[model samples]
Structures are given as C-alpha cells and as structure tokens.
Target: MSRKLSPSRVTSPASASVEPSTPRATRTGRRVLAGVVTSGVCLCLATVPASAADVPPVVSRGVTIPAFYTPPAELPAANGALVRTEPMSLGLAIPGLDGRPMPGTATRLMYRSTDSAGQPVAVTGTYIEPSAAWTKSGPRPLVAVASGTMGQGDQCAPSLALEHPLTLTGDTVSVGYEALAVYRILATGAAVVLTDYVGLGATDRLHTYANRLDQGHALLDAARAARKVPGASVTAASPTGLYGYSQGGGAAASAAELQPGYAPDVPVVGTYAGAPPADLTSTMKGIDGSALAGALAWSVSGFAQADPDLRAVVEANINDTGKAALKDASTMCVGDALLGYGFTKSSKWTVSGKSVAEVIAADPAAQQALDKQRIGNLTPAGPVRVATGVHDDIVPHAQARQLAVDWCRKGANVTYEPVILPNLGDKILTNHLVPLITDQGNAIDWLSDRLSGKPAVSDCWSMPLQP
Candidate 1:
C-alpha cells in the first residue's frame, strides 16, 4: 500500500502509462472510488472488521466458517496441467451491521503455489483457457500479474471497484490494478495470472515495498500453480510476457530481474513496467507535503510490516498518538486517508524526535536498516520496458528517471521510455500517478508486444533528475 511509484507524469514511446495494481481492494489506485464525485482520485473500498478475530479461513458463503487457518499441509506441486474446478470457499462478512460494515465471502477459483516459507498459498484470479470449451486459438499465451494494494486482511476490507458504493454509474466491478491488467493481457491471447500478493486475499504480514525478489517469486509461483487447474500443465516455460504499473510495475521489474536466478526455469521474455517507484527515498520526499499523505501513511505502515527495522524506526519516532495512528494507518484505505488523516494531516507526523520522523532522524541504527529496503541496485535477466509520467506528482518524474538511470547504469537491458502527460496539469504534484488512469494504455500495449517477442526500443543514456 505504501508502494506507489508516485511518478508525477510520464509515458513510454513503446507504450503510454496504465495502472494494474490497487489495494486495489481499496487503496492502491489512490482513488477512494472511481466515481466522478470527488475532484481528485480516492483509494477505493477497504475491509474493516467488527473485531480483530476476523481471521477465520474458508468462510464459504452461506455456510459455517470452514476452520481457523492452520497452514495447509503442503502447497500442491505446480508442475502439472491446468484445469478449473469449483471455486474454493471463502467467508467475507458477518451479517450484522452493528456499526461494522461486512464484506461478503464467496468461493473463488485459485491457482496454488508455494512461497519462501514453503507454505501452501493460492491466488483467486480470472482467465480464459483456449483449451476449455472456450477456445478459438491453440495454446493461449500466459499473463501472470501481481496486484498492487488491497488492505492487508482477508475477512475485512473495502469493496472492490465495481462493487464499491462509489460506483460512478457503472455496473462493472472496479477491477483492481492486477485484475484490470489481467483482462488486457488476456485480450492479447494470453491466460493471465493475478497474484493478490501476500497478506491480501491470503497469507499474512507481507506486502513487500517494491521488493523485486518477492514480487518475482510470487508471480512465477503463480505460473506453476496455474497447472493445478483442472486441465492445465505448463510443462515447459512458454514465451511469457509481463506488465504492471505502480506497485505492479515494481513487481514486473522485480520478476523480470529475478527470473534468471529465482525462477530460472520460468521462461520470461519481455517485461513492461509503467510508473514504477524504482527509487524509494525519492518517492518518499515527493509525497511528504501532499494530500497524498494517505498514500504515504499506508506505504509507511506496509513498509514497516515488511522491514521490522523501519517499523521500529517509525515506532521510536512517533508519540503514543502517532503510534496508535500508525497502527490504525495500516488499516486505513484511501477514503479514510482524508482531510485530516490522523497524524499525517497534522504537522507532527512530518516533524522529528518528538514524532515518528524524529525517531527515524535520531536513530543511528536506522541508517543500516534503511539501506536494506532500498531497491534499484539490481539488474533484470531480460529486456525490460519502463515508463513514467513526466507530470506525475505522486511518483515524481525525477524519481522514476533516477530509477531508470540507476538500473541502466547497473547493466540491466532497460527499454527506458519517457513521455509527458499533457492533460495532467502541473499544479497538484500527485496527479502524475493518476495519468495511469487516463493516459496509460500505451504502456499496456507495449508489454503485450514485448511478451509477443516483439523487439523493444531501449536507450541507456543518463538523464539528470531535478533538485
């Protein structure tokens, strides 16, 4: 959730910008809702529980809670064929509205796989298998995606876009960044893999901060998992393509870079990353003074979950109220990241020693801690296509540019494409990331082409970032 690339404005010549991740359940896209009611974007529906004990597993719709989660006996070996069976059971909400909003639960289809923890994990996503009763082509392409943000819980959270009350006059579900992109990838003759990411949909206490290794492993694992479907087997690594924006962009970049080392056998060809937050520190500075404080708060909390040191740093900096707020902040969605989002709106969160900022600023040990979470030093295993909005305020162009510059220098074969988004005005600093909403189709198409084995136009020149 704290992983918005925050590129102010941008696009790639190979492709324009497009976003495919979101708390997508309620926050990542940064729009509280997709409706036109508000002037700017809002992070959409996020789940909130009536109580903290909302951790039951397999809450089948209209049935008793299956059981409290005990890690699965073992993840199914993904080295098999693909097929669809009945959807697995899930419970989303409790019927009473006694001051608590309930999210409904339903059985969803999933592709299962293992993780670094060797835990049996699964992803509930969509795809059109040509081999199924619905195929016109032979061996459809595969598109595996890692979603952006969805508040970090299974039972409670906001509604997805389409289901959100903030619907702007559409019956369509506000598909999240990954879900939305899955459709695009599928449209291009590929069966997509939507990785809901850890701590969301399933798993616990994980949502890497643009951590490429995590993103790559999760995405590749989904591919192996896909074979678990009723009639599918990815016997050999097919010609695969990757695309993502914002958090997903980071995931795509991460997966692309880690393909050779981590998922060595997974055949990954072309990769497209739109408005990725390649540079962490730069992104934080850009959002420090914006209304996007909500995004900042979510990212910080999520970051803490992944990097304990950072969490301790944050804990030391803030006061009791700040601590409570940060705790609550982790549970918030874009909507709640409102006018005076707890301490984010207050000047205290921005200040030091007396607050979380001070804790970070004063911590001598934090220096070493901070360095671990920093991305951009790694290189990709294949051709990577990258983009940014020249006018993005949320993810400053300078940061994206710096990231591209950094990776290029590190010898990653990056197809770095930079383009300006005109309609996205210059006033609001964050409106930049918003372009992925209105101005990012090309980026999606570029990825499709790359995956299709189309050659990309990449340049390695260094570009200076603005002070």
Candidate 2:
C-alpha cells in the first residue's frame, strides 16, 4: 500500500497512474493492470466541486484538514450511529457523460464506533454511490474498503484522498492508492465505503494504526453509517463485502471475524484480505529493518494509545531517539516515512539496543497488548479469500498463509491464494507490493460471486496438502 514515489512522478492530480509491473503476467493480469491504470488516470483528472471551496478548513498536526473531519465533543451511546455528513467531491469526472461524475456521488461522514476499550469514538469515512447499474442478483450491494497502511497522520486519511488523490506538502506525501480498488468496485455498480479507521481523520486523537478492534469496528460501522446516508441507494438488505490489503487486509479480516458479534445487522457476504498482518508479533519482526520500518513506530505508538500498561512499558524502555521517531512518524504519511525512515533499524531507538520486537518479547505487558492484536483466534463468519505474495517479506507471506490455515481449522469457508512470483528484491517493497496488483482481479471476482448469491466452495480440505 505504501509506494516509494518521487514528487516528479506525481506532478499533478491527473498524473498519478496505477502502473505496477506484474512479474508472471497472464492475460487476466494484463487486463487487471490495464483496467486499474485506466481507472486511476481517469479519476486523477477529477476536478473538485465548487462546494468544496465553501467548506471550512481545520488543522491537524500543522496540516490543514477539511472542516467536515472535525468531530463534536460528545458521541452517541450506540455504536455505528451517524454524527454528521457533507457532500464530497471526487477528483475524476467525465464531461460529456450526463455531467455527473464518473464512478459515483461522494459523501464525507462521521459516525460512532467503539474503541478497543468499548468507548464510543467518532470515526470518519467516505461513501460513494456508484452510477453504474447492478447486473448481479441482489439490490446494489455495499463493499466496505479498509485501506492499507496510509500512515499515522490525520492528513494521511483516505477520506481526504478522495478530493486530492496525491498530495505533496512540505515533507509530507500522501497518496490515495485505495481509490483504484474503490473505483473498480464502483464500476460493478456496487456502493463503496472507505473508513479512515479511528483517528486518522478525526482531530481528537492520533491515528491508532493497526489496532484490530478499532479498525474492524470502524469498517463495520461504516457500512451501518453508509446505509443512513440520506440519498444512498444501499439499504439494510444490501449485501456487504470487505476488501483490503496489507494493513487493510488485517482490518478486513478482523471485520469478518468480528461481524457476527460486533455488527450483526450488517450482512457481510465475503471478504478479500490480501497479505493481512495476522500475527502482529511476526509482522513487527518482518518490518523492522525493511523499507517501511516506520510502521514499527506506528504500531508502538498505537498500542501505547490503547493500553496504559503498554504505554508505561514504552515510556520506560524507549530512549530519546525512539521518542523523536515516534513523534515524527505520528505526523507523517506513507511517502514521508518511506523517504525519511526506510530500512532504518528499530534497535537504534531503544535504550537496551534491542529491536522493538526483542523488547516486546522481554516484557510481558507489551507482549499481552500485541497478543490482543492478532487476527486468527476467531473464525470469520462468511466466505473469505486470503491472498498473499509468496515473496513478500515486509508483512511476510508465512503469517498471512497461516491466517487462512487457522480459519480453515475453525471450519470457516476460506480460499487461500499464494501469489507465486520470483523475489523482486529484499527489503525494497517490490516483492510486497506486486501481488496486490497481480492478484487483485481474482480477489474482486471472488467477492463479486459472493455478492451474487453464489455459494463459496472452501478449499480448507486441500489447505493442509499445499504450502
């Protein structure tokens, strides 16, 4: 989800392209790549609506954010309760085609969702009502998209990306890469809801990156809030599907596992989790010296936000370097992290000269906090597709594969796809990112089938036999 990009690569809003190389390309792979590239290019040309100028601006971590992102002092008692909403502008538009924007109408919204501690927190997201017609069986279905590793800054919020897909301000760099998936789903005549997770958009707190409960609840509640959007075509009867990769894959997987109990009212039909960080401990180790090493700071900062004991552990164990890195990372987006902290060692930030993972292994409280973040303990309720890059070392492939294996053991309907590609490189992010593009077509098609009321045949029986 985090791409290493230079400012020249994204000169203007329209210049961004979804053009990643597919290693073992197939006809379908070529088609999927072309489709996403076309979709991204078209959307990049989108102009902000006139109304966007009238909305007041709010600032977060020195970056001016939209006023719509500011939450009220108090929240509703119920989870998934709508707080506020406003008309949003999608950057892309087709001029000659009825004057309406291509893809759909966008709405920026804030809703109530429970935190890891069961406290009601306001969450922000964007809901897109597709202009295309649903050719499938049911009423226009809803797909709740959880974005992958957008960074910890409020300015990095995915909802903000709808208006400006790519931003380069001072040292911060933010890209709405998730838009490709959103646009693809919309092209199928399905409504899309993209959650900003807990604090990514809201000004009240720092983003709790990779927190399972917070992210899962935010995604499920987004579906509930989307239904309440006054003009949205989606209703309670709309079948819901979850989609995400990397960090988002973890959220989608968490949502599927939590849906049965957290938001039973939301009917989640299927889930597409690509390279989910199922085991946070293992994931932390994988990302430590990798290109996206800043993510380790995000995890530490996020865990500290939710757990007081873990916070205490961090405060006592972390040195001045660790504190500054976490502080810097808090205000940074993916691109900023990639530029400033890529391939940096986590051991440099600690007092004991041990990596964050090593420190966590030594401390019981920190280990317990991270243990709560693991995703495969519970069975996901619906048919779920788990895809992982065979060569991915950033989030790591083995942990992702284990998530499917764990779910299969629980008897949950599951489809496991191992994207076998040559190792693009080590610690550079190519191996981690390519499969997200290569396998996306099959992932979308699988979810489409579930939304069409087709029964999913679980490959759990064969999982044990394959690697």
Top candidate on TM-score is 2
Best candidate, lDDT-wise?
2
Error of 1 at 13 (Å): 57
User: What is the C-alpha lDDT profile of model 1 across 1-467, one tens digit per residue?
Assistant: 21111122112211112333322232221221111112222221122222214333322111121222212323345521222334332122234344322221222334454433344444334333422221333344566666554433232121132123232111111223343454445455565555655444433333333544455666776665554555443334466666677777777776777677667767776777777766655565555556555556655655554454565555445445544455444444443444345224424653353433335546666655555545566777677777777777666676777777777888777766676556455435445556565545676676666656667665775344322
Worst 10 residues of 2 by lDDT: 24-33
Model 2 segments more than 4 A misplaced: 1-62
Give each prediction's root-mean-square deviation over alpha carbons. 13.3, 12.6
Task: Provide the TM-score for each candidate, comma-separated.
Answer: 0.68, 0.87
